[model samples]
Target: MSLAEKLCLTAAFVFFMTGLLTGIWKYRCMARSENAVAPRYVDIAHRSSLMYSFAALLLGWFAGYSAYPDWLNSVAAASALGFFALAIGTYIVHGVLRDTGNQFRKPHRLGRSTLPAWVIHAFMIVLIVAEVGGSLVLGSGALIAIW
Candidate 1:
């Protein structure tokens, strides 16, 4: 496997570790008080991290199967990894800081009006486009190779 693919798999492991930590946090919160519930963002972060990890693995495998150029593979892997970290980190921050309420259930007002929110959303958009666009190009190249 290429270095990029290896890195993607490593990211999957990291995300799993993050989930484990979140689980522990939840357990502690429950132990402290029967009525205490783990922060919504923490739960969302744990679950989404797992999903993103799987996505990273799938993208890595697709990149390898498609025999994408080194540069393209690198870009796709990097974007996937970047998005994964950003998502998990944001979740952890929101959970720890408790700046907003139940982000999973309701849209935060900051997302609609804040400059920082706009920058973060824009960055996520760019990463998604790069990762998906690269994957499509690589998949097409593989199809052409087969034909």
Candidate 2:
């Protein structure tokens, strides 16, 4: 198979994985009411998992778009690097302040990145947000917006 095909498959896999993990994590979070082991942290980790899945989707898009630059995965390595940096920064800010970021001005509540797990979860939420947001913003939008 060509590099594009391989990347496409990889991207598809990532998308599927993201959806799958999100569903499972959602289940676990809900199940916590029934089971003691099911803590909110599972959801936190799943949030990041969802982000990975999104990043994969974007990379796949980039790959399927064209087979140029073997390293140019769908989101671009540079973009991924930036995403990670954002995740880390958000995690740190939330952890230190125990509150939502002032810049983004999100409400400061339970998911304020107080614990390590919360930071990771925030990272995932932020990551996927960036992924989907990037796709919408940077993408040509032909495939996404048929309207």
Best by lDDT: 1
Report RMSD for candidate 1. Answer: 3.7
- Per-residue lDDT of 24-109 in model 2, one digit per residue for the tens? 75675576666634343344444654565566555555545443444433344335435744543444344334444332443334
Which 10 consecutive residues of model 1 have the lowest summed lDDT? 106-115
Please report the TM-score between candidate 2 and the true structure.
0.37
Task: Evaluate all candidate structures by whole-model CA lDDT and list the values in order.
Answer: 0.69, 0.49
- Where does the lowest 10-residue lDDT sum fall in candidate 2? 101-110
* lDDT score for residue 131 of model 1: 61
> Which ranges in model 1 have alpha carbons more than 4 Å from their true place?
102-117, 134-147
